[model samples]
Target: MHNTALQSWGDSFRAFVHPRVITMLFMGLSAGIPILLIFSTLSIWLREAGVERSTVTYFSWAALGYSFKFVWAPLIDRLPFPVLYGLLGRRRSWLIIAQTGIIGAILWMGFTDPAQNLTMMAFAAVALGFASATQDIVIDAYRIEAADADLQAMMSSAYIGGYRIGMIVAGAGALTIAGLFEAEGSYEPMAWTVAYGCMALAMGIGVITTLIIGEPTVTRTDSKYFHETSDYVRFLLMFALTVIAFIAANIYTANLTNPLKSGLIDAGMISELAGFIAGTLKLAISVAAAILTAWLTTKVGVTPTGMVQETYIAPVKDFIDRYGKAAIVVLTLIGVYRIADIVMGVMANVFYTDLGFSKEEIATVSKTFGLFMTIAGSFLGGLLSVRYGVVRILFLGALLSAITNILFAIMAHLGPNTMMFAGVIAADNLSGGLATAAFIAYLSGLTNISFTAMQYAIFSSIMTLFPKILAGFSGTVVDSVGYSWFFIGTAIIGIPVLFLVVLAGRMMQINADKQAEIETKT
Candidate 1:
């Protein structure tokens, strides 16, 4: 029986390498490229153009759109786009809109000068970020939904592969272009325009993807069929609650809602009442979830039985009951990898400048080599995960990422050698690319399709949260400790993560055992 299960595992791994799975690698690149252009790449450009360091630092706040994307995730989940929705369906519709917005934002920035219209540029960039975040939400949902349970990991790998490619084009490619134009110090227009043009070209991949990849089948909605009875009842109940809340507030404030509205024509109490209701709803949902988890566990031996055979076997959920630690390993490793990268990233440009590398020089070598390394790393990592297994690939990826950080530390200490700098950037991006694909595949294995968007968002957000916080202080850290020590500190931060990965490995084995036991019992 154990041998049979092993055979099944082997077959599953083999099946993952199919052509459908292969396509996701490029899709990942498509999703990834424009992100840095609007954010990190933009930051470097601003800093180079004599924008105040303080202002460059504050511009990071524009990323709030990403952190808060869960707010509009439901809208993307439920609301269809106007004209585009009819043609591309919900998933593709949202993707096209967001991608179009990203292109427009980039083009606008190409034409504007931060020195003359920094405020306008800032607004345009925020719009890009917001659009990018929306695109991510939809792209994630589409990827998860497009494949069956058996294929999600492949999709994840593909997305990462594509994403790394995009990053290379946007990050390193942009830098290289900037160098070409910025050589004479009179090439700001050319540099910025080239950077923006790369984004425009990168969006072509997404457009092609939109054209080629068929939309996932959606549950058809009747526009007005549910409105008469069930919808009206729900509306009335909601309306009743609103009225009662308003009355209660008015009574508490001695009829302030009416008097204020009459005197100042101000809309009163609605916002406060909405907040109160929202809090109550959140609390109620939490309680219901707790109750449901307890009830389900009791019925299913505290570990669910039966695989949810959809697009792919959700490795995360499948192992959650049987191999608890394996799930932790995947999450912790992903978090550590990203956090380490983010911590070092914010300080990288400043480090280059301080080390006497001009913006042009930094852009030329870093982007050209770094982009290719990242793409190679992601592609190879995905190949490895498919050829080997998640655990092995993860172990290798974590080790590579940790070692690469040390490489950067070495480069920092070695002083200003462009070749050495290129080497460090290449290694760093390579590890980053590999780790990203592996991590996404690992995370995808854990999700249930029903909660695909929400779960992925949760994982992606948690991973982003700490790293972003640490990154926020990257400038300050570099300012205080200098570059060499800062890179070394970032390297050291990976130690706990490495330990956590080992712990996760043990958990995966335990999960495998538990799963075997269930198979026997059934």
Candidate 2:
């Protein structure tokens, strides 16, 4: 027993030093840097430049590419780059291209002054989001393909560790650089420009890593979807038409819903609820547009029947076939799992600023110090999941995650108390790290290795879609009810997630038992 335990510990420690696992660290850093620049960190920049809170929140939509990347994930999965594919192979070729896009987008954002031209800044941000989301798709696929099943947990941990470190650089590192450049009580556009320039240069780490790493040998399942040149052209055209239709429908729906949303808010409905209804209405419209586009494409023979179905629909069908009726429940759980964290998080930097914390202070406590706390929580969560099982730890994580938001509510009432602020940051990040680790493990388990890229992308994209859409209205909620009530409301919203977790656990257990029985019969 002693020897067995000692060997287990030794094996675990050695996994981190594996070359592929180490490569994920750099890949994760590359993936992590651009996100905060597009969202939370960008919020601080806008707010400081005197952009309206609602407008600042609206900028969150720029990162909507993250939620929708699944739309093009199939292309990344199967489509190969022309020259780069031959030189660097499939995964690295996409990695380099995506990284290059990230660098260019960050530089573009640095040059555009949000105060002078918010529209241009929004455009740049959208570009950055697209590039970053594409990088994520490629990196996720690479992570899955680069190693065997046993190494995945370690790879995920390494990726997340590196990702958080990248966040620290983008968050704390960027803020510190900006603070150093800008004088007190003055907004110097040049300060942010220089800061962002440095960040753009930092993307070289990813580029260099991609150049160094060898491509994983992926054994793609034979697909009849992309055999002919006409097929590729047809797929691209159909994808474009579908996207245009969705965007058009979303715009039309928003125009129709805006008046109703205003009326509800005027009639004593909460702004958060109203905004949520508007977003849901828009989502429904957009989904309908996509379905219509798919149907029309088939009718017109833009692509052969089952071409789109084979590329996009098949991964989803694989999931549905595996889970059957419980797929809906599982998907619902995925969609809502991160709501409490993301909604409250979208406003965290703004909240600190509102409480009169300096950017330096926020960077130090929230970004730098809090990062270590989160790492600790991640390690602890991983360890506990092994001991207590994933489902139980997942439930505990959900409870802790929801409960920690109340700490934020309490801190809001306390008002700019640094000690209280630090404590709250610690608790929030710890729970966030714990919840995220288990949730990712759960997501990783759901993917069919055959559809590693697309299936995982679908899972991740759905994970963020609803939460991000609702998060865009965070400023409206805070503006309506103030920070205390806003935090409390976020906590309240998480209550249903706990019930969903319980249901999912039972569902998985029953399925496992049935599978075990079938094996026994066999």
lDDT of each: 0.66, 0.84
1-522 per-residue lDDT for model 2 (tens digits): 001122255565666688987898898889889999998878989988889999998988888888788888988877778789899998899999999999999999999898999999999999999999999999988888887654565667677877988888898789889999999989998999998999999899999999999988767776776777788888889888999999999888878899989998999988778878877888888989987997899889997888877888899998998877778889999999999999999999999999889988997899778898887777666555544456666788888888999998998888889999899988988888878877776787777766777999889978987898789889988987999999999999999999998897788667767777989999
RMSD of 2: 4.3
Question: What value does the lDDT take at residue 25 in candidate 1?
Answer: 59
- Any residue pairs clashing in model 2, and if so which? none
Off by over 4 Å in 1: 1-26, 40-59, 78-90, 100-121, 148-158, 164-204, 217-334, 356-358, 472-486, 512-522
Best by lDDT: 2
Which lDDT tens digits does candidate 1 get at residues 49-68? Answer: 78898898777767667876
RMSD of each: 11.3, 4.3
TM-score of every candidate: 0.66, 0.84
Q: Once superposed on the true structure, which residue ranges of model 2 sit more than 4 Å away at CA?
A: 1-7, 40-57, 113-119, 178-193, 265-268, 339-363, 383-389, 403-420, 465-506, 509-522
